[model samples]
Target chain A: MEILNALINITDKGAGFLHSIPALLIAIPLGAAFLAPILFKLWKRLAEIITGLAVTACLVLAIYLVLFLGNTPIVYTFSGGNWEFIQNLLPLGIVFVVDKLAAFMLLVVSILVFFAYLFGLKYLERFTGLGKYYTLYLLMFTGMIGLVMTGDLFNMFVFMEIAAISSYALVAFGTEPEELEAGFKYMVMGEIASIMILLSIAFIYSSTSTLNLAHLSYAFTQMQTQMASTPGFRAGFYFVLILLMFSFSLKAALVPFHSWLPDAHPSAPAPISALLSGVFIKVLGVYAMVRILYNVYGFSWESSPEVFTALIVLGLASIIAGSLLALNQKDYKRLLAYSSISQVGYIILGFGIGNLFALIGALAHILAHALGKGLLFLTSGSVVYRTGERDLGKLGGGLGKYMPWTSLTYNLGALSVAGIPPFLGFFSKMFIILGAIDLARVWDSDPSKPGWTMIAVAIIAGLFAVVTLGYLLKITNQVFWGKSEEKRTLKESPFIMVFAMVSLVVLLLAGGVAFFFWLKPELLGPAADVLLKGTKYGELVLPGLFGAGG
Target chain B: MLILGISLVLILIGLYAIITKRNMIKVAVGFALMEYAVNFLFAIIGFHKVPGMKIIPPILMEVKTTANVLSSYSDPVPQALVLTSIVIGLGVTAFMLSLALRIYNRIGSFDLDEIKRLKG
Candidate 1:
């Protein structure tokens, strides 16, 4: 009876309750992460339950933030809020600025993580060291949630490392020669990304003398305007930005720097693969990059169209290279891995377009691809669980008969990824393609002339969606429906696995249509508005500087 | 400035080793070198230039220390950050070396060229 009251109290969402949430969002996972190993020693079963409960709590809190945290951002500073002497001295202490963008990310991560952990519980029955696996998984979870919430640039790098390091270990958890090698490759690339990011932070610190994102934004803008035509400063600025782009592109698996992904992603145990491909890259790579570029540095589409164009070139390369390369891959997971790169290209393309529709499409693609790729990877795990087969050509047709749920979910997920009707991916792709067309026709930074070159680029990008369909359909034909004769000894996956897969599919379908059509634009508008606000982000986080001084 | 130049040269050498070296252990070494070079830059950048004066520790050494002296204190923020970075570097290097050991246990070689089975 007492416990029930406590549970009810936990659900209470009041003004006081809401203020404490941003810190709890990070603290719960971080606490659980450290507690997991101890729980492992106490009781093997206890760890999984704790993880589930913690993840569910995170999801609930995230949803709370989404519902209540409207336009007014939540600024939770780590140190005392009284400001006292320290506050007047400087922008002291790490602050978590939970605006619409941050809240949206928290929601996306928690949903995907909750389902993936649900899937992992049943899926990881074959593996040993469940305790250690849960520990690292929780750590990575903490890192992901913390990465999104923190308002400090240096802290973001710290969380990024925590996530990156743990993931490298998780990728090699299988300990096979292939898995270890893949992990090594992944580590090398990931570490390089980290180093570059650290170097950038150092650069920012040297120039601005503040590591807080809001403060840095304020100072950086001040510096740029003051020395608008200084050649040396501009050169240095471009250098740092280019370094960041290269580093983050590597993290995002954008074409030229994407070699490690096909190997690293497929080589991980399937659930980790799902987490990595689905949410990890988007958070660590795309989200972080966008935050730094658009918000902190305050680069705008109108002022710096060149940077956006460079993003387009990268997106174009990834789309073309990723799709063309996946055509002949016989391995099932590897094909999906390559598909991830291609799918990610569309997200980058949306960012490249850099308008409201394009940005909305890109953010929506982040959601759609997260669920779609997650479902597909979970389906792959189910197939592996039942039959231990990963090769498309070798996996005979008749698979649907044995594993109806897995096959059905896979198809739903595949269709979504390929941008078919009703599923979330289609809507996201539609927005992106529409954004592309709009870019050529309407979104002209220079009003004197039409964007003719952009139309050709738009057309090519729009056509890549069909190419995506081609490769995905081939997977269906080859793996699940191909005519074959083999003594079939396969059964449907566990209830938990199927439930997780089906839930993702439902969410994918519901979320895609519901977001644009059913849900009020007020919710989605603020999210995209965060990006559109551009350099004004600093003003939102630290109003004293940008708000009053101007 | 001299320290920055030295660290930059060290970073270049580390990059060279990372790019050119085939041995997995040497590659790890290159990573360490690069990490140290970066760490060096972070630590040195915090030093406040006090003309003809000794470097003051960031701690409050005396009561009623002037605000000007407090403001002039070397940037302890980056130093604190570098400490965190070093610890992260340690965790990363330890995990990486363990991976190398495990890989060595399996294939009995540290040559990256030999462990190229995962290429597309």
Candidate 2:
């Protein structure tokens, strides 16, 4: 009850004019990305130190922002707040609104980014031209935090482009023919998705005449009520939403739009891979889509049942197809990449159920999958760095004897991702199942009759958790354990790499219990409330929507 | 509606080129075509038939802002949005073209088929 009180009973607290932190969050990374090359030219070591400091600073600000956020969001309007003559509030100019949901996402992005930077410090030492790599990497980092912070639609598009373009460069950073091939393919698909997203933005801006998210929500709410009866307006309105969904799904790598992921993810260096899988897809794709659909458009299961239903269908396809395909992979990294698709399917499914419990489940899955998959990828990097081999069949057999830290952490990650007990992933999956069951109960109009379809969805979702175990354990059975004909000289990774992996595992272990304790009130509850409250977000941002549209 | 129809046609053309053309250069060209189409659509969104919109730019310091300027602005917000979007497109294009050049140096051909070394 106390924990619930923490989430529910949030006061503005003392952080009133401390609103400039949001701008600093974006500027720190952007400044670092631009300065990295010059700093490298002056002293090779200095560039990385600056990058480290920048990422750490961002993390500090994000943590402070979330705690300071309590319940009411921190609204920072660029240029508008600094000048009085302009007279800008929510309706005008670019706004950065960091509500509980955005703050939650901000914390997630900064955590993974900080660790990935740590892992990369040693991992990328072998590669030459370290300057540009750090530059592009930081840009990707800024792009992520920027998009998450922005409450303007066009600003979101711009940040999406920044992240997408840099990732394309980073994916091919190794410069091998195969890496180039993967990068090229990823660029094409990503650009296509970008154009589609741009088109969707244009369509919305044309209709609403406002790009600010709060105003769009106000305009959309008014439209949903007033013009909803007009068949022409309704169809066009829905078409815009569907277009946005398609473009973001392409970025998210959900089933049909998934080809780029397996190629792009594994092709990048390990830390970059971790960033892409653990955070990129979620922030740019899932996070952005959820923001538009729920907050901006004020969609819910009740308001827009078919949209939820469509998402459920997509979620199921990705879960089944991704898990089934991963079972056949020989490359360990590729196999992990495929399962990312499967896990994302689970997250989307939880959201598609579109109930409060389901939302909590979905948000938990995002956090779990980020930590679990991130740790898995970092471990994969350790293996590759030491052996320079990625093939599971060729690289394998009884390797755990040598690399104890890597092996131990890998097992914990696998166990967590595979949804075993006492780990964060298990709780996330458990919450989703409970949510599905809750949804099923509500799905049936008659108290006497059970909702058969939703019950099946619950069972199917639960079974896939086991399927997650199946593919992940293949790594244990094949790569970590088993006898080999050859005995090769193997060593545990450097202390730094091991340290990075251990930190993530520590997060999965202690963080799981902490999340459970803080579960209802502090973190996920208010964040989920942002979705459940729906159009209330617009009202919160801009009170009295009366003449606000004009 | 005519402008929207034209943009759709351009989009279809771009998609066709991307899907059917085997040359890497042609694929980049296809992407540029789509970018142009999308940019054009956004800019046209700003080109209202309101008087003085074409003759006088709306961002001038002299012009007094009106709340209803949105529906009536001759050249409005989408124009600025398109400019930013176009610059982003330029960044993406430069990256893609440089990558293509490097790929060409290694393979000695710009064939998409040759780039398919990674297993599906």
Candidate 3:
């Protein structure tokens, strides 16, 4: 009897803890972010400090949650206080969930935001509207955290828009002509994408009669089996999926849909650019794509040939197109932005290959890209700060003479991103290539099919690898090694900016060195598991209080 | 069905305006209109034959006690989603307007041709 009572108590406590996970991570940041603008009125510096503290607290909590929470999912639900109908349709109310995958993303996003905020302390001094900047920054941070944490698909869309909208405003913070133009173009495209996403969601809800992601996944599976005879229903479902993929691809800035990125990333302030390239696109675009495709749709490259083909084609196009575009860019930041597109292609290719090693490689590359790209953008920001020049042609040689630390950090970042050995990028690329060869071997076993297609794709990916190295080397040599014709003197950027860049460089090196020791178990392993057992997500997410009735 | 038709027409008009309008401001306005059409479509998709759909969800006890309310209502999830979508639209619209204003201030003209400062 004593043992039975103890078991009952344990279950009760587990239930309570699971319910609180979302409120702890999402609600706190969201509330703090909303109140920050008002708090700024009392004390400007106080507001910034408080926002940073909240994000740091969030990061610590996320790490703890990831460590302690078992494989089971956590759900948090909120019902309207008085309305009876709303309680029945819990989907109408706000809901948040933090599963293993989302919690891991939360950790990455919080770390990036924490550093960006620290960097912003000094970097944002020249820009007007300090309070407004912090407020929006925190708000965007809150949205990103929420996006990663939420369990509801519609809620995900809401958070996505919140982050995207803030990013559009942040990009044009300078109010310069080019900034405004880029901001406008980005806003228009973003709004259209949101519209497409909403339309898809509406269709999905109408079809499934549920808004909860896990519940919808179960419903979709049921429909897939039951409606096998109904061609129209299948067609509608596929159409919604396609719309979703298109919208997310637009946000991800995948090859054909990436017209706005090169302009917007360069136009934004450096910290914002870092946040945009480092975490924003990943969380909003890549993360969502992975979550929806793997969790909700139950896609596997082996099972879903069409989906796999689409992913590979898109990946190849982004790789070749982004590289070719970067090859000719003269502006310093624009070149980096184009390079981001190419690197994102690498991540996509790794994921699409759908092998265990390749998926892990993709997640690892994501971390490396974030650090490398973040460092490079910060360095570019410093260059702009010291000289007020963005055109690479106008920039003279021997930038390292003035700022040796920045030059070294920037060079390390460039090398890492170019996939040089002993860096994080090299290991990730090796894994992807190995996975590709494994996939080719598998295809070859089937004598009816041709392995040439995958072989060609792999060759193209390798060629872009070289192109990436070429441009990065060219930029590094031109900026840091060449002599200036004008004979101008340059000074180092603010201490805070240099610190941020160096810190990111250290992380890039550390991540590369400690990939197996640190990153694999914490991030890559869990992410790979999530994608590998895609259909099992539905099983894990169901069986909760608000779950679909079996 | 009528609402769907209207939304389709509005979307086509918005696309035309975005493609043909020389003024950047007008193009932005076109995009805004297109967004509105989508928002309307979302609202319509969530609409049900029954009336008195509650936007706010009630407590669990009330849900257990109430019978007619649960059966005679539309799904409110899409409406809530649309509210969020509308708010996001507003934020983006505000940002786009500000960008247009800044562009005018910088270039002294609202025409796309005049704001050709950035070259490929």
The numbered model that scores best in lDDT is: 2
Residue pairs in clash, model 1:
none
The residue pairs found clashing in candidate 2 are none
Q: Native contact fraction of candidate 3? A: 0.73
lDDT of 2 at A206: 85
For residues A1-550, what per-residue lDDT tens digits would candidate 2 score against the true structure? 4632342233223454346677777878998998999999999998899999999989998889777785667776655344434333345666788899988898999999999999999999999999999999999999999999898899999999999999999999999988998999999999998999999999998888888888788888778665757898888887888889999999999989999999999999999999999999999889998888888888877677888888888888899999999999999899999999999999999889888888998998899999999999999999999989889988866888889899999999999998887888988888888888998888787666458878998898999899999999999889888777787889899998999899998888876788757855788889999988887777777653433444
- DockQ list for all candidates: 0.85, 0.79, 0.60
Higher-ranked by DockQ: 1 or 3: 1
Residue by residue across A285-381, what tens digits does model 1's lDDT show?
9999888888888787667878988988898899999999988788889999999999999999888888888888888899899999998999989
Off-target runs (Cα >4 Å) in candidate 2 are A1-17, A80-90, A446-450, A544-550, B50-56, B59-73
Cα lDDT, model 1, residue A121: 89
Q: Which segments of model 3 are wrong by more than 4 Å?
A: A1-21, A80-93, A485-488, A544-550, B1-3, B49-71
CAPRI-wise, candidate 1 is: high
Better of 1 and 2 by lDDT: 2
Query: What CA RMSD would candidate 3 show?
Result: 5.1
Give the Å shift of residue A362 in candidate 2: 0.6
Residue B114 shift from truth in candidate 2, angstroms: 1.5
Mind giving the per-residue lDDT tens digits that candidate 3 earns over A3-85? Answer: 43443453343575545656666655776777777888898877787788788888788777778777766655555565434
The clash tally of candidate 3 reads: 4
